[model samples]
Target chain A: MRFVLVAGTTETAHIEGISAAGADPALMAHTPSADLEIVEYGQPVQAPVMPVSPTGCPTPAVITRAVHELTEFEILALDAGLVRPTSAPTVALEAMPGRDIRHPRPVDSAADTFEAARQLGRSLPDDELVIGETIPGGTTTALGVLTALGERAVVSSSLPENPLALKREVVDEALAASNLSAGETADEPVKTVRHVGDPVLAAVAGMTIGATTTDTSVTLAGGTQLVAAAALARHAGVDTALSVATTSFIADDETVRMNELANDLSLDVTVTDPGFHHRNHSAMNPYIAGEAKEGVGMGGALALADRAGISMADVREQVVAVYDRLVVDESL
Target chain B: MRFVLVAGTTETAHIEGISAAGADPALMAHTPSADLEIVEYGQPVQAPVMPVSPTGCPTPAVITRAVHELTEFEILALDAGLVRPTSAPTVALEAMPGRDIRHPRPVDSAADTFEAARQLGRSLPDDELVIGETIPGGTTTALGVLTALGERAVVSSSLPENPLALKREVVDEALAASNLSAGETADEPVKTVRHVGDPVLAAVAGMTIGATTTDTSVTLAGGTQLVAAAALARHAGVDTALSVATTSFIADDETVRMNELANDLSLDVTVTDPGFHHRNHSAMNPYIAGEAKEGVGMGGALALADRAGISMADVREQVVAVYDRLVVDESL
Candidate 1:
């Protein structure tokens, strides 16, 4: 079955001293590269450039854009909240402006935005929905949400060496900011999001509930963020089958306890082997170096392409081509 | 016959020295009363209250809200662009943040935003679509686009008296900025919107095309702003059955030759009167005074209710009740 990827963001990425999204934290807002990449594919981009991870790799949205071009999978860019506006034609979840999570109440209208996303989910065609997120510093929020739910969680990141220290510290600050003990926040997902989580978490979680409530198979297509959404869905008693599809890179991140986190969260995990190691492009190197491990539905796009009988080689070639267009020629 | 009121904004409303939207044109930016009002019928709002015309009648959103509550038609709130975030859950069209039309090219991404709206239009359930728009200062932009499209358009206003001189001057300025003549922009609706229209115009026009392309029975809701959308749909060769449903205030405004404009534009128009004169609430006075002649899908909502066997008195009573809730209890 074809898949649709929902993209969202969070302001937690732009915290004064956090780089959880990528090496250069400021570029986190330009994350919706899929919008421009798809529109200007095979063309030159001027003015604003495609966002680059600190490691010199393009956005994971390139991966999703390539898959869309190759397999014709319908893709959706959802603005949960972004510091910068997406040029891509997006299904605005109408979460409004990018939110700063530094505030005690990060998302005041969490319930309302979630209802909107849920309605959007229920309205979609029955195609399997592969939801993804690209909020910079989002994993920190994810870690915050998961930890609030009482699981010791570590998530991979755009940085080659995961910043476990900073992530933990931020999670601690988030919990403190909420003025709620982690245990108290665990059973209240909506409250959890309002206190510490960003708009993306609430939107994705709501989208999951909407889609799953309608019995659509949903692949939470990223790492810890999806897990946070799954936790919310599970808490809300959503019975639709849900799974996490990611690259082996995320699965094999030595610093992260993915298996334990998944098991603790009761989320099904599916890992795809893109075999980037065997690929010829230097563009794939940053991915292996672990900058932007998985985002913008990269893992899920790869999985869908694979399911459609598209090869890893084909996926790699498309990624490399998009990378060359974006990085080499500097065209979006 | 369910309806979706897609609300958006343009910085054009916030333009200095222009009061084309309403008496207190500065409040034009907070025009999402359609969103919150339609959602919470008969309620008071905080921070941002429902827009009130100079005559002190509430925004037409009150009319739409009363109808929506009276008839259980499914409603969707769409965000094209807004200076303030909508308190209600909304399907965001993600047309970047509100742009100042004073810049001459307010909606640079008009084509893409339209495509997104069109896609959204195509994805709705098989129910007949009634699309409405709410953009403060939108009437002037409507005048600009309509005039550019070769129609001697005179649109109604939120003020009891029309501001024809200032509107014409601004339209002239917009034409000069876009470097286009009235005849030159006639065949190009997207260009017309990008040049002189707001995000609401592009989004609603795109929605019309999308639904019409898919052969969905579509009703263009609201006033002259929707006329611009109909003009775009017609210019684009959309063969779907298209009609506009508006309030009697819009059709019978003696000051504005709406009938001549409609005939000149080759568009079908349907007018619904909620018989607001019989209503007892002082809040409904602004509408009768020619303030906020149409907005937030109020006209279409009333027409749909009237068709569904609801009486004008019933609609008016609901409206009066909501006015009391908003003015007295403030429950939003």
Candidate 2:
């Protein structure tokens, strides 16, 4: 089946790095065997500014408009974006100027982007409705949202090496920031999004729930988005068959709190790391590791499996081989 | 970790099904939150066996030993049994007989299994070793081998649902047959295994491979064996740090084609099912789908994203949810 990739500015530079390393070319070459149709979501762009400046936060209106223009393409692949953390904390925001506290780009909240994604989902044909996202500072926001929603979420800055430590720090910070007790909602899931969540997360969550038609499959590309989408699916009460894919590392205890939230929601999840064999050990930064812990593109793979009526093993082999080659190229 | 499951079984009166089911109470009342080490692999047993004549196939000595010693405590937590198929085409024999070949158990041809799994890795740990099987028409020989290998693989026989049409007819024909391929080496995996594959599928494939030490942070669990595993790791001559889990719907194709095949040749391979959701659907049959496809698990999951760590939205969500559930149970 044809597959579309929604590109976001979240880590646009990272995507560029991957492309420059020939990941895209290698992947494109293998398409014949996998029978996948891939298209990027948003046009390539510079990283969005973070912590709105004196110029003011890029208007959400601009983001909305840009997305609208991009949607003009007959087939919208996937929605993704970049994330930048504000220098100050949310509680300290009152003392800072709006420009100082605001993040660059108008879509401040995951909710906004999620809303756009929802609209995109609605716009697609039933069978063509598949969505995904990318946000650089997303893990941090994911922590924010998960904490805000009263669930303990681990947030980490991207490190080229030692991502586990970063993940631990984020999880610790989120746990400390939240007021809710852990495992209190043992019988059911606690409302994870309402507490310390972001706008983009909310938007993706909305899009996933909104696009729950039988024929459509919604994929949340990043670890943070996957957590958000699970919370959304749980809260939205959408029961259409769904799948989530993430890195093998993110399946660890620190990051797995999000998974617990998903179980409460009765969602089927799949964890994967495509380029396991080609991991860049020399460039191993905690931030990168933390991001690697989250991984990406697993959601779409599941959708493909479902659509193709193939087994999970078949898909894993195809993706892993391509991913390994791509990552190896990057290391070089 | 706490895990919840819905138990289903088609065999109980016979030893074959029971051996393959692994643990029951552990599978059922499995609460991830409880102070217990829980792993759910087997489903519950259903009916008693109906008297039937022997299928007259030579069974492995190892399989026979494992079945005769079955007990309640072991039933709570143990590996499932593997059996050889007595009826059905070689391609369609991946699943157990009378189990509605819709969702067949994944099995790999001997060569593929050994090349992709056995020969690919370092020696396995003794403590973690336990075997399981998935071949149809495997019990009788299990009895024979228990008499020979000193293991219990068969206790009783359950008549096939439609004995006259499928199981019985196939068994009787086999009793009168002779020429069959021997050893792991053969030209065609499906054909080789069809002539000789047995309950060893669950045992040898499951036990030996399961004993290896790999990172479980990411696991590839489902369909076939060798190819699925190799695909996940890509066998690129690198030490793999990722954890892989595999499942089989049929025998390994490689094993049937090669001689002097070593078991540890395919460390990169991890087999698993394609459909992780296991949702009940009338339009699809899991077994058929599995046999038609090859390789799965973590490898398949990786294909959904851009090699740079971009994931498909849907795959991310699904994997995250499943992982979240797994983690939550672990914490419990």
Top candidate on lDDT is 1
Residue lDDT tens for model 2, A51-99: 1111121111122112222222222233233122111100000011111
Q: Which runs of model 2 end up more than 4 angstroms from their true locations?
A: A1-75, A78-114, A128-130, A155-199, A213-215, A219-224, A236-241, A247-249, A252-259, A272-296, A302-332, B1-332
Worst 10 residues of 1 chain A by lDDT: A38-47
lDDT (0 to 1) per candidate: 0.71, 0.30
Query: What is the Cα-based lDDT of residue B165 in candidate 2?
Result: 33
Evaluated at residue B217, the lDDT of candidate 2 is: 23
Model 1 CA lDDT for position A317: 89
Give the alpha carbon lDDT tens digit for every residue of B85-132 in model 1. Answer: 543545567586446655678788788888888886765434578988
Could you give the DockQ of candidate 1? Answer: 0.03
Write one digit per residue (lDDT tens) for candidate 1, span A119-233.
8676554457888876777777777777777666677776677777887887787777778776677677788788777778888888888887777788888877778778877
Q: What TM-score would candidate 1 get against the native?
A: 0.56
RMSD of 2: 21.7
Predicted structure with the largest DockQ when compared to the true one: 1
Please give, for every candidate in the order listed, the TM-score of chain B alone compared with the true chain B.
Answer: 0.92, 0.25
